[model samples]
Target chain A: MDMVRNFHMAQGLGETSYAQNSPLQKEVIESVMDITLRSAMEACAAETVSIADLGCSSGRNTLSVVENVIRAVCERRREATQQLPEFMVFLNDLPSNDFNTLFSLVPEFVQKLKAEHDDGGGILVSVAGAPGNFYGRLFPSSSLHFITSFTSLHWLSQVPAGLLNNEESVNKGNIYMSPASPPLVATLYFERFQKDFNMFLRSRSQELVVGGKMVFSFIGRRSHDSHEKINECLLLEALEKSLSILVSQKLVTEEKLDSFNLPFYAPSTQELEDQVYREGSFTIDSMKQAHDWTIHEYAPKMLSNFSRAIIESFICHHFGEEIIEPLFETYTQLLCEKLVAREDIGWSKIIVVLCKSAAS
Target chain B: MDMVRNFHMAQGLGETSYAQNSPLQKEVIESVMDITLRSAMEACAAETVSIADLGCSSGRNTLSVVENVIRAVCERRREATQQLPEFMVFLNDLPSNDFNTLFSLVPEFVQKLKAEHDDGGGILVSVAGAPGNFYGRLFPSSSLHFITSFTSLHWLSQVPAGLLNNEESVNKGNIYMSPASPPLVATLYFERFQKDFNMFLRSRSQELVVGGKMVFSFIGRRSHDSHEKINECLLLEALEKSLSILVSQKLVTEEKLDSFNLPFYAPSTQELEDQVYREGSFTIDSMKQAHDWTIHEYAPKMLSNFSRAIIESFICHHFGEEIIEPLFETYTQLLCEKLVAREDIGWSKIIVVLCKSAAS
Candidate 1:
């Protein structure tokens, strides 16, 4: 399936929707708020600052990051005794994203921002939705001054090619890179990430100004090996187990499960740095690994709902919608057992700040 | 009701949707294609042309105009043997508009444009949705080069405020400024139009660069009097008749019908010229009135469907959804009788081409 045409988070504001289940993403945003604020302030030196939140799904989390950036820029300008600059924010995601819900939330967001600017000169914020794949071009040349993407870049433009040899699934019994998968499976996934990430960098290089900064936070692994046992990988293993159970019960076909692999990859810090350097347009300002240990505090059902929100569209596109309820139920039960045993529920997040090189 | 929050064409692609029943709008667009093409070519003299379609509701009609603009720009450049410039198009509408449907139509629209450009250098087009009320600021200062709002400016920012006197509806029998409306009703509506039009022009002036061009096509009347007998006024009379029937049937309350008025005004050529001169930002290039006689050929049911598509949202907001079916049934029957009587159905459309003054 074409990712651009079909991929999306669970739409709307229901209990199973991404809008209602993105507290984990909100936590990631808060954890990296300082870096986002600093980058936004530095980028706001211009008279009109253009900031784009790539892969900004439908939720308050999307605008909360933008709100933080705008507030920081306003405070910094006031401190320096400079005029508050106009802000043109672009909220970007795949075309299949829930843009209606995102836009329905804009009036109140703009109202609150304007209200907060009562003491200073009035704030000027214009938010537009730019819907497209971030792996390609989305803006004009030298148009954006700051960019942020939270927990979004792990999604490759498409499922990795070459996962099949002679029309047979090479990575059977697994939905993502795992220790049980063959080495070639990891190679194919890594190669796809390298290609997609490089294209992303190249596109942003043309769109961003010379001194523009970008802050990105996405799921990551601690080891350089692609087949490491990260928390995300473990979660996928539990999901695979649930699907396998369904397959054994004749609820889903074995061939369907074998043919399914998520279009995702959690890169290591070294891997991210290497790709950025190889792209040769951006200079890494800072890179840090953060481990959020709060996952153990959440009920297993909540975690299951969160995961479902993120992956339900993908699963439905492949396995059909009938499997969602049973699939999530089994996965939630497995998660309960794992959480009760306290089996390393920590999630490792990588935050990177990069600036467009002046000489590029 | 909040116009910015509740105002939109009917949502989705169902039979009653604006997307499915916009042939009259399509005719208006085709009628003004020459003016649109001229303004687009003039605006494309720059390297990167920024074009905005204000009040671009969800439908193919929205992108058809932009497609014409891009084609004309490309042809002009290829004739001059200049490098193909990138086009940045912004689709502006209310936040409540069905942007998902609009954005869904984009990939195919863009792919067709690119495929047609295969003989020339590859086309570079980026389309984004700018959701907001056009009566206020939407873009940064001097950011756009061309603007188009077809059949949309007739909508005022809100209903005229003085329709009531001491808690009593002044225009009790009519939903718009008909010949039977009081002189004060006409005055209030015209004053609202003047204020909203001035605000719209002012906002566009700030967003449009010097020498930029804008083409606007909207419903108009031949007579200078706001209470003149126009086809649109006649159509609203039919709608008012249908609503009165519902009120008598107790399906809708009399108070509800009395307090409801359309936030719309059709200006004469003289009124439009006066407003343009009074605003003092844009110079009138040309103004002409075009009458579409083809509307008479359509079935009365088709025309009633068209009207319903445009006003269903407004109706559903004020009246309950249960009244829609019966109301439109009465409207279609009324239209059939009017059509059989050979009533005048010619729609007067005013097309104005304006250029941003260099001095401004």
Candidate 2:
């Protein structure tokens, strides 16, 4: 997949936009807020604090997270009896992300920061948009003090390379690793994650100063087994079922359904830890897993909308825009049935806090 | 005028877009490229060179200027046998500017840079979008090494206060300074320029490191007389004439025309130098004036398009979008008659290079 061109959260503030349907991601952010605040306070000790929120898709959530970071830094500085540092917050996402909406919200964001901080016009905050893939270098070396990415890193750089063997689909009838897929499919996905995450770590290590901290929260599997039926995997399976129904109804071609695969993976906690240690530039500070029980309270329609917000671009790229409404309708029906059966519906998110190693 | 919300160049890739009608601006950039390159080479002496292009309205000209700076910095470092510095280029404009178009072009820009530089994986360049009014702070303190703003300082932070006295429009029948404007109108415009430009210098002084360089090119007058019939004033006179005709035809109200004034000023060389000295942070390095003779070579239709590209937003805000076609059509006719009469038709731009004072 051409991730840079084809991958982005649904843009704008429409009903199906990531901006509106991001409550699930917000819950994850809320769950990890304490860790994020602690890491920011510990990492920022300079006169100018540079923070970047990678994959900061357009929404109220993007700046809300940044505002919290700024507040935490100010509180820490005040307790230390130090002057407040100027802030340079770089909001990063794919070039295709809707930064117009993000930047439009900045003036209000700064105003709220000032009103709440009561810094006597001393808080200097400059918010800039850094549009690029985060698996590469996005900032200058040692320029950033704190970095945050929430529910974003599961997106691999590209669909695992070599999903086909000699032009024949190897992971047929499944868009991601599933029980029906061959073992090699899981291997390919895991390998791709390793490669992309390694590049992500190495690039950020160079960009962050020593002792700078990174806090990340993303969907992950509780089980060490690759084929575990995590909530993320279950959602994709439901989506696949919807696509199969479309194929059966002749609205989509069978070949198209067979050829598509998601550029995503929900890593096991052990897998994430192992990869971080292998990279060797960052020392693990803390890692915790939280299963969001809040999903049980959400209606199936809301879940479908949330799913569409995150993957609508990928779906539109591969299947065309015509399939969106009907496909999501079918997916919503599937979720409703699953809810009736009392099946699991919430995500297990792993939040990890890491500090840049001094020796690196 | 709400400069942040209402002022922006004509957006997108249409015939009337600033992107298409910016050849005149391109000529100015070309005229000052030597000064820009020299200032860039002299300023970027660190391992991580940070550069910002202020008021970088969306267009090819924006990145084209940045590319030249990068090339010059690399060449200088190569000559000195120093390691190439990683570049962090921030492209800044008002929040309303068309950053979507600007960012969409970044990948191709980076690809061309790498292809030409043959850096062997060494030349790291990160481009970010800074959306804010540059008259205020847009970066962290002492973080920038070089700043370039081309043809952008002409825009005041807002329209001069008190164009109305006791609810009476003082600058009637004119959108900007002109021979017909009252002397109080001239004072109001100059005072606004002094305040906005002083704020611009103070904010940038705090942002730029000591000894950092700034290269600016903007519309300026040659003669000290504010009412001199410079080409810029000539163009506005033609525009005012068109608007008067609109008022006569009932396409626009006389009250609306009287109330609307552009948030722009064309400072003379003396005015600009005096402001810089009074700001007391940046030392004047070099100042030169260049008359763009190319405006005479442009067709009247092209000139109309260029004018429309620049002020269409302001016109749309105050005079309504319905008047745009007729107003510019009338503007084109006036330009055609002026060309036939061999009248002055191009701008006189001032190119100033200033270095942040080490003592400051």
Candidate 3:
């Protein structure tokens, strides 16, 4: 989870150019954000409205997506000649995120917005900073008009506990994601995520009045089955390879290396759907399995860089700093190998837009 | 190429188990061997003969395959016992190959062969210690009846020259079989393999009687086009991953890692067929692609072991040995990432058995 946060931080700081360029990411974000903004406008019946980017990484793309959503909603509202509501924006990320870096570039963004609005003749627009963890409560009730979180939310706050026990019975030597890891590890992680996610929804449900809409984009597996080789085997294998190098070099002892596993898990679209559905606070407006190539083509460098940054600094904090270089070398090599091997085997960042409305 | 050799060598030690477990491999080899053997028997029409297993890794499986061929012929010979001559047998492999390992268990094999023979069981089975590469020249001309080499002949005597001329623009920076890598890398590797393979055929062509047949299996790709990702990308990715790890660890240094490339080219079945047809000396009676489960199921392990045994030990021997563990770790990690992300994506090892009819 920390790794994911760090990655998103780096991504927000213009590090995800690789991801933005990806047709898959671009298309899905555009489509879902489009639908989301439309729903927000319809539900609120506002000619213009405020939008919040929750866990907004430091990327121009995030704001760009919001800008497109705002424009989409405003354009539709103009047809009704409804008085335009003031447009306010808030960019939220972890307090530790590089918001300073993000803040530095905001002037230009505001200037561009003003320039466009001035040229079009009249619309009040406001943008603010909200740096905090999404897992805990952050916003005021009934404050947000619309919310967007692209390529976030799948991350847990931490790696699930006891996953790295690596006992002999557990076959820790190479048990990447055995069919028999007992769902305990996954269940624990999911439960925590559920708690956090439910809190996020409850918080958002309160902040969004009666019908504000929220849209999110995140990484997900194609299947819900944990034993699926691609889900468990591939990433673990890469990690194993990196560890092997560390062991071979005698930098990290074989024993220390054998007793570790990664913390994050990307659920499938169905799993995400079920969680949202069970929450029962938000009505599912739309969902989709985003095209993978879109993400790959856009974030080539960032994909590799973001992954390394998280692994080294956040995910496995126990890993010695000296091992970072070797770890990255191993990690990047594995990533490139995968990219070149299969065409359809790219990352999937899903988009889900929902409206917070009471059951009829 | 070295990887291929080591894999063959390891499986050679337990060929029976491998054949029994890997049905596709067994079927592929059997199909080709059967056709070639039948062609040889029909062409020979001789009452008696001597059969030899050349470059036959170390396994009773080779004898089993050969025994089937001899028995089928012997059954025909038994139909005319008055004109039958006793059959002689010889099994061969490299000096480095565990022949003693094979010798320890040969009694059972011989007894099985003798007991199976009908005519007073006078099948003179001889196990010879002819240990040399089949690439250059090994057997005496016109001295053998049947020749067989299962899963051999595709490997070049050594990593091809001109594959890693770093000075060349195309040869820069860890490119293996790159679309842009010096035309010579692929050409040289292919030329060397062709040269060595043709020599193998010529040696066998001369050594075998007018009706002699040779059965062999080696690695081959599913496509002739350079765009094929199987050979070009997957293998190169592994090499690159290894080098990247070495680079990160500062073991090989970036410059040296940049200049290294493995000396191997797994041709497509079509390409192999074309080569044999061009030789004209040996008619390709049958050709098939063998399933390599060991390569598929235990690829990371098998590939790592292969690199240690052949590649790391031979080619790129200049690279510091201290980084091997790190290098392999990077390689495996990259491979693992690719594997886990997908359900099933692997390679098809090709098996081809040809016949040399004095008439051809």
Candidate 4:
């Protein structure tokens, strides 16, 4: 409950807001846009096509995917059959998302739809927000034709249980599962990921009609080794260095750092494939893995703000707002030096397109 | 766009908040609880049952329906099938609702669920808030097993077009779709209701699986006469008289009154049945209509605050907060005297349960 109250992409159209700092997410979403279009065209057979974008945090990017889907489907149908289905677009996030900002953007989005279609119901478009956790059932049985998520499936519903108070915290000296962490700690993280990922697929499977398609992209490890293969390793290492500086100065408590575990995971391609096969609801049609983080394109300031937007709520609740400016400053400088030293910052994003089976 | 920001139910759990003033809605929901349970049992076939409460304004009432659904389903399944399906409940409302307050109460709600089931894995209840307009699709196609909406569908997406103009609003003296209004004003309100309600049913039809059920209860009319049959007739009349007093006192503007038309409509039983049949998605199983408002059971103070909670956003936006206390004061006294005159306040409520067909 407190997380919902405190966790949100910053509101408003200001520079620091999620609306401004979301190009990274947009990049990941755009990477899968073609697969999303092709898969939907293959699976979509309804008169009124329904599509849901899960974990749809507030931003212009929220509508970017919706527009892509709508435009692609409409143009393809026009070329082939001279018919268009009315569109139902559902944008979902946690309840505390900046919906006011999102809704303020809707009128213009609707106007664009009108410009594409005709005024006399060439196609009717209806959009709404669904605020909930995606780890569980957020829709009805066999209800959706397509579901798309970007850079959000990595967020576990909660921090993995048993990581805390494990004799002194299994993930001690760091906030997330890292290479420095012990074998037992790595196992715990993988177990939690398996549990959560299975739950996500099972819930979405029930909500999706047979042959419905889901396209997802998230930060992931290139190999099963948690510390060695993670895409955001350099970034996490920089965050750890900043925290160590604070702790060494006695400005921040070591205990606080020990207890705080990032409820995040980067599954390997092998791990993802194994989960898909075991879950037995969806079959992977294609998968793409790319180490695509660019130091020049996404400078340190941009990347710092991006990380801050996602984790600020929990950090603020723990370390107080006073630590935010200085902490991010240190993080920014550390990440910059590291990025300059090596072009490979070691962040690989994985994108996959999967289809719900006809029988499951 | 302005409507989403200015159309929120009153916030918080204070005396004047919607949370405190929502018992009237609760009264309506309680009247249909048994029907929701039985119809859902008959229609539900999946191993995991899904249910949604649409227009679930914040407070104790949001969970009231969910709890009822969970308890009844669990008990019935235990009795007949010797097995209970895992449960998924989606509580839906507009974005501006007090979801923080609602989520704060979830821990206790989950605790109660735990206390009710003891078989270790008897029932796993997952509850989530879907913040969106129910007049559009909030879920996937054929996903839901049951849907319940109470006292919310009457709100048109926009104030019926043509009720206002650059010059002035057509229904100058009234704040809602009253019979005394001009013929064109009534037609516009009916037209808007027809469009919005048809969109609502069509969207939900695609989201619900075959044999899924929907139960709805909202303020309506016992007769087609707009000046009569409504439960809020006396209260609206009193509100009109109070606004007239303000206009005469030069404390309010005739233009403001002219521009204001409540986004509310209480359709007659005939109108509802017509919409249901015209939409052609579902068959009405049973419907109950009653002019059941009791002056003694509900004091004037209680009733007036209820109206204030719902309409405060528009009132504050147009007339400012300064008028709230005095206006409701004038409204309470007038309604009290009128209710005393005949013991009949002339408000009717209609409740209905409908079933999706085997084929769309």
| Top-lDDT structure, candidate number | 1
Q: On a 0 to 1 DockQ scale, where is model 3? A: 0.00
Tens digits of lDDT, candidate 4, B218-279 = 87877776555344566676788788878887778888777877787778888889998999
> Order of all candidates by lDDT, from best down to worst?
1, 2, 4, 3
TM-score per prediction, in order, is 0.98, 0.98, 0.44, 0.80
Report chain B TM per candidate: 0.97, 0.98, 0.76, 0.95
CA RMSD, predictions in order: 1.4, 1.5, 33.3, 4.9
Q: Give residue B145's error in model 1 in angstroms.
A: 0.3
Better of 1 and 4 by lDDT: 1
The CAPRI class of candidate 3 is incorrect
Clashing pairs in 2: none
Candidate 3 structure quality by residue, lDDT tens digits, B10-104? 32334222322333334445656656567556644654465666655544556667667766776776776644444545555544454434444
TM-score of candidate 4 relative to the true fold: 0.80
Which candidate achieves the best DockQ against the true structure?
2
Residue A222 local lDDT, model 1: 83
Ten-residue stretch with the least lDDT total in model 4 chain A:
A1-10
Report the interface RMSD that candidate 2 achieves against the true structure, in angstroms: 0.7
Worst 10-residue stretch by lDDT in candidate 4 chain B?
B225-234
In model 4, state the lDDT of residue A141: 70
Indicate the residue-level lDDT of B358 in model 4.
Answer: 77
After aligning candidate 4 to the native by TM-score, how far in Å is the CA of B147 from where it should be? 4.7
Model 3 ranges with Cα > 4 A deviation: A1-8, A11-28, A31-33, A119-121, A164-183, A231-240, A254-261, A294-303, B1-360
Better of 1 and 2 by DockQ: 2
